[model samples]
Target: MPSALLIIDMQVGLFHGPDKPHDGERVLGNIRRLIQQARERNVPIHAVRHTGPDGSPIAAGSPFWQLLPELELDGDIDILFNKTRPNAFHGTSLAQHLRSGGVDELLIVGMKTQYCIDSTCRAAADLGLKPLLVADAHTCMDTPVLAASAIIEHHNATLNGAFARIINTADIQF
Candidate 1:
């Protein structure tokens, strides 16, 4: 089955200004590597952007809506889906896009561990798409009760082999 990399919610809204979360810069290198590898192998790459109502952080035209510059995307992106909800599937064409592309497996990487990232993974499973999350590729801001690292570790451990498999970027041999 053909696989696609679902690069979700890497927009400027999540990374620019204020204190950023969980070393987004650090994990970006890994995301770039994955993009490069996928390109070389002719694998499709789809980008998901999140938008919200006025005054929302991810409102349209905000700097945060743009993807980070480090993980460069070319004009040849397989698909670009705009989502208003946490789950990428909610009112979006993501499922149809994947199905039309003949994509059976998905490599997920993005932001906000407890929100978009987590929700999308579960939704993909519900849609019968095999979702593989890059363990170290997604991160979140530090919370008062838990550090960012701990949150990431917990999500990986809790979600591994269930919500999704936790694989390092290096383990993606495809």
Candidate 2:
């Protein structure tokens, strides 16, 4: 199946603030490697950035709203999608963009495993787009109820086969 890499909400703000995702550096490295591989294979790469209301960490126009510096923001090959909702396809041109490019599957990676990543995967499946979640390339901060690692594990286990197939970044093949 034709696939595009969908990196969601990998913004600097997620790394800042008092609460940050666990193993952020490692996750970033994994995502970077995946991006390089995707580029080498000429697979389309799309980045979805979350935009929050005013005063939020990811509010539009704020420094934190920008993508992390590690990402290669090449306009020629990489596409950017700004989203106000957790589901990147909600009110966004993501589905149309994918359809127009003949992309049938999405290799997903990025932040907030329990939120945007989870939402987007389920939404993708509903939209008839196969989603492959890169297990090691996504992260989330510890919540009051659960540890970050547990959240990641739980999502990977629950989402697999239902919404997406959870795979490691190193196992990804274009």
The 10-residue segment of model 2 with minimum total lDDT is 12-21
- Model 2 steric clash pairs: none
Tens digits of per-residue lDDT for model 1, 1-174: 789998888888686757687888778888889999998999988888888787887787677787777778865665766788889889988899889889989999988888888899999988998989999899888888999898888888887787787899988977
Candidate 2 residue-wise lDDT at 7: 92
lDDT per residue for candidate 2 within 90-151, as digits (tens), equals 99999999999999989999988999999999999999999999999999999889999999
**What's the C-alpha lDDT at position 172 in model 2?**
82
lDDT of each: 0.84, 0.91
Estimated TM-score for each candidate: 0.93, 0.96
